[model samples]
Target: MRMIQRRIRERGEREIPARLIGELVMEALRDLDPVAYVRFASVYRRFEDVDAFSVEIARMKEAEVPGGGDDPNRGD
Candidate 1:
């Protein structure tokens, strides 16, 4: 919601594009929780198979945040 609010403020409360709103919501979910992000991304991006899930997860693993993001597959 903060993202949307910020965009609204930036745009002087003008009509925001649905695509931008969706992207912001997805971004907020990603920052809040990986599982949630994946869940939303799957639906939003219309993921159709395990391959899509794997790809999104792999992309997340690669973009791991600093001082966090332990490898889920490495048994850390």
Candidate 2:
């Protein structure tokens, strides 16, 4: 990604933090593709178990819709 590279260059730091790079990549991925975002998050977050992945997926699903996402009380 040229954007990521430009960002790192703008920082003007000899050593860049991995977390910053990961965050930039995540932002780009989120706008470009949902699946890619999740994939990158899994590795960037270093998910150790299924629960972690489940939690991340749930978060994304919730954010995808308004009104706090789908709910039984909403009567979909």
Candidate 3:
């Protein structure tokens, strides 16, 4: 992760492919413990502010909504 960050910083404005980043993350996570994955994701996703983290969580919750509503039991 630090290597990726350093690469980006050293090569400013260069485009890094999403697939490459995803592959790198997956490889890194494969050897990491669950808690380490969470820690890495929190920083990697730039959840520095509470609102940013809240927005990401809300997006996840919304995706879980089958029919897109406040109902708890509905699957679709």
Candidate 4:
């Protein structure tokens, strides 16, 4: 977590690669309780609008579906 903060501070507005950050965060949360991961994700995502939040939720739901491409609202 300190490393993430340090990188952000040094990089200014240059965003950390999302995949790399997600891996790091997941590793860090490995030992945490379920609720802790939710808390961390909420803050890390800095969600500001319903549309953005809903997109993520939809992605998660899609991943969990039996047939991954079975989304009714697939095309946007």
TM per model?
0.75, 0.70, 0.41, 0.41
Clashing pairs in 4: none
**What does candidate 1's lDDT look like per residue over 21-43, in tens digits?**
78888888887899999999999
Going through the candidates in order, what is the number of backbone clashes in each? 0, 0, 0, 0
Pairs clashing in candidate 1? none
lDDT of 4 by residue, 1-76 (tens): 8866776577676667886677567546634444465456666777677676576556655655679858676663
Which regions of candidate 3 are displaced past 4 Å? 1-20, 23-39, 72-76
Which candidate, 1 or 2, has the higher TM-score?
1
Worst 10 residues of 1 by lDDT: 67-76
Name the lDDT value of residue 33 in candidate 3.
54
lDDT of 4: 0.63
TM-score-wise, the better of 2 and 3 is 2
| Predictions in order: lDDT | 0.82, 0.87, 0.62, 0.63
Kindly provide the TM-score of model 4 when superposed on the true structure, using C-alpha atoms.
0.41
Top TM-score prediction, candidate number: 1
Tens digits of per-residue lDDT for model 3 on 44-64?
776778787566556555655
User: Which segments of candidate 4 are over 4 A away from where they belong?
Assistant: 1-22, 26-39, 69-76
lDDT of 2 at 40: 92
- Model 1 TM-score, all chains together: 0.75
